[model samples]
Target chain A: MPSTTSTRPGGRSARVRAAVHHAVEELLSENPAEAVTLPLIAARAGVHPTTVYRRWGSLAELLSEVATSRFSGDIVVPDSGSLREDLERWAIDVSTDLSDPDTVALMRATLGSAAEGGCACVGDRHAQLDAMLERERSRGGKAPGVQTAADALLSPLYYRALFTTEPMEPGWVRGLVRNLLR
Target chain B: MPSTTSTRPGGRSARVRAAVHHAVEELLSENPAEAVTLPLIAARAGVHPTTVYRRWGSLAELLSEVATSRFSGDIVVPDSGSLREDLERWAIDVSTDLSDPDTVALMRATLGSAAEGGCACVGDRHAQLDAMLERERSRGGKAPGVQTAADALLSPLYYRALFTTEPMEPGWVRGLVRNLLR
Candidate 1:
């Protein structure tokens, strides 16, 4: 409870940032229907409201940042020995993560305002897919481009989670993995 | 323009509805960056603000309805002799339509709120896909179900449009069609 700046670099600033993001994720996952406001998020985060506004500017950007950090930090890119197995496992993982209503709400929240360069999570996913594909190629495996992975592997899951009522049918993710390999 | 109840059935009421929808489409497509409001749309449509509010209730609902009509009425389900060709053509058409910044904005505007049964445009698309697939089956042409068409054919495009900055690459739509046919 009584920590100094020595243990935590950037002192309270970094801790506050982490706390805000964690609070957002918890609030979203607990009740996707809850109207998430800056004040509410600040209260839950135990940070001043002014700090959030000064830091993130708007709720959309805050949500985008939270979503981006989630993709980059929370989830791990699969690195199975085989390209097919790796992509299949990755797709299933993505589908499972997106199947949650909270994640879907978070995803939807990140979009729909101004399409200024799209979301940061996309670039994050691309880097992730690139990492997976790079591992495959290093192992003397054949794989399609990142765009193909975006098209074949990840797009269907995101599209369903954002647009349709049905997220994933049985064996849906595996079929996508099979397509790129073929 | 002069109209009568005998000539236009619903007369002024139908005309007002059409005008408001046309206004929304124009405002959304012509300048997607415009801050679309009931007053703004009403002024453009030459209708009373109260009328729009009374009829549609909210901008999201209005946008959703306009999007539904565009999918259901404007776009035709491609009908080539072959299922592969038909699906490919349809995919290309969708890619082209969504290639427009206005259409992308319109599509994005339809989402990002409460995921109440997703969007109505989805139902319209499913119906169109079903119609196309039914024709293929009748002609003894093999085709996947509506779900497959959604995942392989449409999902990638929508995913790119909403999530990624790069929408459709050259020959990308055709590649999606190829995956399903094989």
Candidate 2:
């Protein structure tokens, strides 16, 4: 179970959560995923282990919170009146996010844990993606085969990011979108 | 350096390598990537630590050998006179290999090590892929925009295989091929 409850009386709790989330991101950026431990997170967050546990339940849950939080900012949606244009813009955004070193590291860590013992966080990612896709589908935007097209639009960025040592560029994402939707 | 060469060469040597590889695969299948260890691999393989060390420099190197061996079979390059058919066949092959429980475990372990210390084996996988692409390009059997098309054709299967807990089906590969090529 995740610790979603606010410890303090209202606005102050949000600040604490934000601080902890930021610290987790910073630590994940600097260290390998395997190196992150409860003690390190607590030390970096300037909080006690119990507090983190109370909030996020386990280290996996906390990491999931941090992972999801990184993408909580503005999401890019494509609406260029052309499916190609829409997909290209969306692909670029997804590619950029996947290419980020911190994002890649966190994903690898999460996936590694999933491989080990089935991380519940991966389900969260899927649900988030499904919701976003549902939103897109509900809109007037429709492709001939959107699900497969979307997978084609997004998978390469992640594959290159995770497997290859080189960073994936926006050009590759654009090329991928062009080839898939052409 | 990976321990590909043993000081003694004979039937026993071949058996030892085979035993070690099998052991590594079994351990990977049974345990999470983090739980796999040199001592455990040795015990499972029925070999001494010295032999394990002599065969592979480190656990990472040994695991790389295991992954390589698992994928060592000849790539079934299709020649059905159409680029789409060829690519679909390739995708099915890759999807089948990736969907295996052992293969998934190996991939998790490989990516985990890659995230931690930058596994050299990833370069090997890329080199193999590049070589295959180069061969196809030289053969001139593929359609226009072969490189981009190839990425679009194959990336989705690999991505789904890696991220999803469900086993990838041959139909999924076929759909990816049809959708990308359409």
Candidate 3:
């Protein structure tokens, strides 16, 4: 069988992976969900279709590589001793990050794409969110009230972003935190 | 200039209206968003595109007609005195209705179709949700413990339905109500 690898041997593999990542990002930037096709991604990344398929298995997986690259950076969890304050800080940061137009659009696209069929990317996204929540809980110290606190802190931001045209303002985040904690 | 009035002093006007309404229901049943083009709708209804435009003015209005025709029968909100029970009933109904594979697929398609570009249907859907919330609040009464009982009551059901493949079971709805009430 002919070798289907896009990378020839050793040194070229890293370069090919980087190229594919960049191409996926560029496609998402242009058209969120509409631009994610395997052939187009392969052409842009200068790899054969077989190579792309061999590497990621599916277009959703390829897109997952691009989407998650930006999210793995350090997420600081403040420990101000007060659970309310800690949650407030976390909500502010999360609301600000999630309220970005591009981010919201990308999320909507991801949801839409997943609704069409199966995508491991959706599972990865959920895992990432769960990890972030877990980290925050650990930092602040979980109480009996932690799960409800977490839901109250996060659900509104997501609901607002999905249903309303208005960007989630800092004021809303602060209000949500205060109300939930109180 | 031809009048855009739906009710005309003619023989075929009433028949045409009925046919259009039936066609809208049939099409939406099959594929909510895909089945809503003016030409296709008119063809299915055995009417003219001009007639559809004359009556509804836009695709969103046409969709609204279909949705209202199908699901607007009656949503009885019982005043059980206990917010948890009332919410449980409401959540079960909403989740059960939305969890229908056809309904879920249709909603996804409608949402995705709206995300693709400017679709008045988006605004219409939001308005409908808001209206439903308002009606429930007035009918069911509210609890003092939660910030907004409505949010706590409804958000999880929606979030779970949108993200997970698990069927919305009665136990899940009961658990959600219990958790929110806590």
Candidate 4:
């Protein structure tokens, strides 16, 4: 399983990957996870259905690739010198991302995949959370364990984002950071 | 709309509703929400598809009805009088519910509806959460607002339930309660 796409930037194969990725985003914007199919994605991307099938064996694999590539640069740990400020900024950043319609669609898609398809790519999200928390701990933040810290700092944003109609305001993010720090 | 079913105990219409409800649970156990349709439910319940359609306008409405009726009686706020104990019990109860395969399936389904279908019945779950929190507050427990309390108390269970492979253990529930209370 060597790279199907070229290592060089802007190559023909790379263009295919990019097209497929954009097609996924477009489909997810309008439909939930269960509604997205390989044929539709291929048609939207203007790629051959056989190419999509060969390149991505299943919908879960394609979604995982798209989610990882799209969100990998979304979160960056802040070094504000104070744990409170760093946590607040990080929480707000994540909140903003979650609040975006496209991002919310992605969240729904990934969570749906995890729940129904048992997709292992869900670990990517937890890994991102762990890396963010680990950075804070390295900078002398006195937070709980990585898992617990994730529950404290990140769960609320996701909770509201998914379950409730309540707004995820900036002040609430500040409160979350203060509570987690305390 | 007047009552489609009589209030009398074990009436004909009551039996019909019960059969339909059980059919929904059974179908959801084997399939995702989108896969469960009115005809399938009617056939499984030994009723007519038109009956289900007339009784419940859409799948989201029907699922919401089933979820609300089923879970309304599941959580009873304990009078242990201590907010810490009460919160821990509630969290564990929710953890156990999330661990149950049927409940998790239902959660995924309803969340799917909320995320994709713009289902309004998602408010039913928040109402249950608020009622539980108000009970604790009425008992002299000094906690955060109901929405925030739901975030602190229940969000982590859902986060792990929907997002990651993490086990929502009893110990973690205790820890969540302790942190939220502190």
Estimated TM-score for each candidate = 0.84, 0.76, 0.64, 0.84
Q: Model 2: which residue pairs collide?
A: A3-A55, B3-B55
Instruction: Note the Cα lDDT for every prediction shown.
Output: 0.75, 0.65, 0.58, 0.72
Better structure of 1 and 4 per lDDT:
1
TM-score of chain A of each: 0.84, 0.76, 0.69, 0.82
Q: Could you give candidate 2's per-residue lDDT for residues A106-162 as a string of tens digits? A: 776666655443433233334434444555567765444545554666566666676
- lDDT digits (tens) for residues A14-106 of candidate 3: 787888877766665676354367888889999998988998887546655555664444346666666656667766876777666655555
As for candidate 3, its interface RMSD to one decimal place is 4.8
Q: Where does candidate 3 chain B have its weakest 10-residue lDDT segment?
A: B117-126
DockQ of 4: 0.39
- RMSD in order of candidates: 4.3, 4.8, 6.0, 3.5
TM-score of 1: 0.84
Question: Could you tally the backbone clashes for each prediction?
Answer: 0, 2, 0, 0
The regions of model 3 sitting more than 4 angstroms off are A1-18, A32-61, A64-82, A115-150, A178-182, B1-85, B116-150, B171-182
Model 2 C-alpha lDDT per residue in residues B1-182, reported as the tens digit of each score: 23644445655777899899899889888987777888899999899988889878777678767766666544556666556666667667777776677777787777655544344323234344444555667787444454454466555655677765555677776876676556
The numbered model that scores best in DockQ is 1
Which of the numbered candidates is closest to the native, going by highest lDDT?
Answer: 1
True contacts kept of each: 0.56, 0.34, 0.11, 0.29
Name the DockQ score for candidate 2: 0.38
Measured on C-alpha atoms, candidate 3 has an lDDT of 0.58
Which one wins by lDDT: 1 or 3?
1
